[model samples]
Target: MTHPSTDTATSALPPLIKGPHERRLGVVALVATLGGLLFGYDTGVINGALLPMTQELGLTSITEGVVTSSLLFGAALGAVTIGRLSDAWGRRRTILLLAVLFFVGTINCVSAPSFEVLVIGRVLLGLAVGGASAVVPVFLAELAPYEIRGSLSGRNEVMIVSGQLAAFVVNAIIGNVLGHVDGVWRIMLAVAALPAIALFFGMLRMPESPRWLLSKGRNEDAVRVLSTIRSPERAEAEARDIRATVALEERTTTAGLGEVLRNKWLVRIVVIGIGVAVFQQLTGINSILYYGQVVLAESGFGAQAALIANIAPGIIGVVGAFVALWMMERVNRRTTFITGYALTAICHFLIGFASVSVPTDSAARPYILLILIVAFVGSMQTFLNVATWVLLSEIFPLRIRALGMGISVFCLWVTNALLSLYFPTIIGTFGITGSFFGFAAVNALALVAMIRFLPETRGRTLEAVEEGVTTGAIFTIRSRSRHR
Candidate 1:
């Protein structure tokens, strides 16, 4: 049986028949996404701090890569291990554990006495970042009404970029003021503790996912949880809907990794999911964040100018995310992905050409490249970055949503880690012209993949999307049948 499109599901959200449910859901979503905020701040803060960090830590090029990528590598492990663990333990509880990891990780980084110690601390933070990426969206998606799922899940991306912008602003102030102080980067690193504490404490007031409760055979508890977030009448109805979907999956085969693999269509969609994640990172976006200042400096901006110019991209990223929030619910996912990749590819080429074609000695060259860099940031933020996250959150089957997203993001971070590791060297060898041309090439390929293979996911219910994904039916967008 074919399901209605997401627009139909969204239009069908049980009217705000219950006041308390909506309020509670909003509160819980905000509280849970604190993890996202911390995720953004911790990662973005490093951008401004890396210079002082390198000087104080006495880092070589190899060590610089290690210090930067240790967190990403840790995040890869966190995304995979915690994703599976959350599948069993429960999303809310897993998030709490992640909060603890974030706190400990931040503390370790703040007090590290040596470069090796800092890398360990960063790795710890990576674990928290990875866990947050997987669990928070799962929690949000499970709790949200179908009509608002796009908007609600999209909020996490907003918070993540907001956190990054906050970090960049804070880093600029601290670096400028304490620019002369020893170990000032530690202060920047330590500030992450505030949000970690907030996320941990905030989770105390939140409800366990109603869908998770249903999956574990606690139907009444699911109702209760749903009641806290939806009207009583709608809560009961949604509880039944959720239970039926879970039952369907269970009857098909016990929902597990094995079942997912046994189904050929499920396997195909999973490959697409993994591809989406990898391509998002392969554009070298985070690599820019990880080493933007270095790249900017190499482009002829002085050290202070490079440090300050880094803030421009962070700002653009935040703005682009808000634009994405608006677009996700309105535009076709495939269209947005194609447009985003294509635009970014153009910017990459322009930046590369500007880096080489524009003479370094010419006063306008650095400025032109800077404008191109900002354009690249805008293109990504406005289209690809948040859309990728939104699609990943929405596309997976309920049984493997967290796992699929986790595995996908794991690849993303790993790709990010490798890029972070080798990016400096790549830049060292080919210069900005060569480095950006490589990204352009990757993005050009991604444009084809998106146009040819990616499916539209804008307004479908999770159950509907799951059936489509698991059955390899996404390619066959038949009109909805009256199955229910």
Candidate 2:
């Protein structure tokens, strides 16, 4: 029934870009982001689980801090070590290895009989979390077209906050309905294994990062992998760009910490990365994620009431992430950071004012504090969290991308760990008002840093952006007009 002329014309034309390949890309992103979900759940579960856990484990305040901070300590190490490993072993293989660690770590935590054993399990989980935190964004960034890189890479943060919300919702349900059950906290800790299993299986079918493939001298393989995720024309174009970048790097010295430190431009970028990472933590977002119930209880809510109310911030967190994804596509990264910090600082001041003005026993105090905290979490999720991770993933050149991200995130985890270890003591010594006031001051400084140093990364290819960074054009006033 077909005409020979029609068949020849069709064959001569480029292959029609099908919808299925795009959907496959989405599926790949979703599966890879399950690691983010696990990262959220593992970190946030302890907020509610710790009370029952402490009761069963006979933990003192010091011991409680140990159990809470051990994972963060491990995460710090994991971020650096696993980041370097990813640079060497490839992102897909490292993530597969992390998936295995997630499974083993979850089993260890579920079966832990003593506080020391529990800390060990948490450390293992932290390693997996840290590794995922470092590698997943890079993987997603590499896989995405530069046009949608922010949204694609930022999805990992959404999954992270969603995972946290999942933990909060699960903890509330379990704690309320099964509060009297023996070792109920174990049930909470065990839930992480489900996602771990899903991540392992899902990654088995996923392709290696094409940029990573190109980095290792596998050009044909890189283009072949890219064809699955991108349109044929775009895939070829991207592969050519990546190969050119890799070739340039090969002609120079190898990318590493030593090279990063030796170059002033690279060091400046690394410093900015470190500042972004640290300021994100210094916003005290994790303090809320890890200790929301405690803050609520101190605000005058009963333990049960605090457990239920903690879900409010978690819900807002997920909503804020949605907003962030929208904004990442439309707004400059610098604008997002400034706006987020400004809002969070305002929320902190209001929280402090509400806590100080309202009587400790006043019924209105808890609700007021809760509203402000929700606003703070929303602001943080919207402007800061997703943007920070996305920028960290994008800012560095390919040569030092993994190691730079690792070192920066290593500082982030360390800051988070120190805060987790001391947050309880801080609340005890300063009360909610003084503690929030301190956070306000820190966020004020963060706002200044954002305005002065952070560069816009939207609407540029990874290779183009890296060229700007290496040339220090990104730091100049003229480069703004070019990117704009």
Candidate 3:
């Protein structure tokens, strides 16, 4: 039944194009993931710098929370706006704009003299971070082959952890070496500017998302871009496939917000997307990234040592993401999410237990608490973070991909904002144990929700997954052939 043109197009693909090729895939993913790295650095930089910033800015407990949450609130807004913008402007251009935002935000944060100024800077940075969070994975997913899409898209998560690790290490060094200096936190906050610059300059040379190009009526350009990254044959075939799907979008003018609300299926999918995004953040991962050093200090570690110890969790988070990438090819999305939630919940309980049971003055307290914190990061990054993003990228239909992902990620950032706002108060009142116990309880509930609702989206082509979601034809497939 296949046409000769289809056969020829398929034949032109190189062997690596047909399946997962680590070297080829890794290189491409790494370049695109620099956006994620900058995101991590900007967000994580605050954890170490907050102490100095608070002292210099004369911030109260509430003000501190506000400063931290402002970025997240900005991110929440950015996720929604930029997500739709990426759909209209193309992923690469959207990313380029985000890179510019990062640069401008960094400059603002580094030079800010007042609390209001600092808050403004953080909010701008949050916008860039939020935009990058939504767009990077989608861009990578659009470029990757189906067989390897999970790992390729997950490269952003890996870079995120790596960026966090780098921030922690830099924070420790800067805080220690410049301990005696006035406003030492400025140096720490300023470190983020370099990566933002790099991301902007580097993205100038990157290719546009082939899928986005096709959607925008630039089919020939999409094929040419795909050919460089994919085998010639695979590129042609994918272009044809994308062309086929674009034809469907052409038949429907379903892009309006009102149209999205009117469609039962789109609304259902959007709700699922929002749940996925919010649940991932509600697990309390960012609390640790933003406040781990403070938690460690509460556990009785000295300021200097706690700063160094915080890097351990950052390192573990990155390693866990790499492991997640490996498992992405083998595990179902539902299974991975369930497993992640269970693990983080258990870790939270353990942390809470350690906090309550261990005497504050005991030498063993900080070490034991540190172990629990690392475990929490490990469980989150390995099982939930990468899987959540990958699922978001694949589960929605092409027509509503940007809208759905934006809305979901907006919920995610808002959840993050709420947690960031309340985290210090929770820790201050209940100590580390009570705070973690709270996270554990919330995570347990999230696990049940995921089991009941989250669909397995790994290992399927975007077109196939979109078809499945739109038609309600299939929920889970053990083999690719069944997807067709």
lDDT (C-alpha) at residue 139 in model 1: 83
TM per candidate comes to 0.95, 0.95, 0.93
A best-first ranking of the candidates according to their lDDT comes to 2, 3, 1
In model 1, what lDDT does residue 203 have? 94
Model 2 stretches with alpha carbons more than 4 Å out? 1-18, 478-483
Candidate 1 ranges with C-alpha deviation above 4 Å? 1-13, 16-18, 478-484
Please rank every candidate by TM-score, starting with the best: 2, 1, 3
Tens-place lDDT digits, model 2, residues 1-484: 2112212322333343666668878888999999999999999999989999999999999999999999899999999999999988999999999999999999998999998899999999999999999999999999987778999999999999999999999999999889999999999989999999999999999999999999999999999998898888768867877787788777764777788778888999999999999999999999899988889999989888999999999999999999999988798888889899999899999999999998987878888889899999999999999999999999998999998899999999999999999999999999999999999999999999988888878866787777768778778743453355
TM-score computed on alpha carbons, candidate 3: 0.93
In terms of TM-score, which candidate is stronger, 2 or 3?
2
**What shift in Å separates residue 380 of candidate 1 from its native position after superposition?**
0.9
**How much lDDT does each candidate structure score?**
0.83, 0.90, 0.84
Error of 1 at 237 (Å): 2.0
Minimum summed lDDT over a 10-residue window in model 2 is located at 1-10
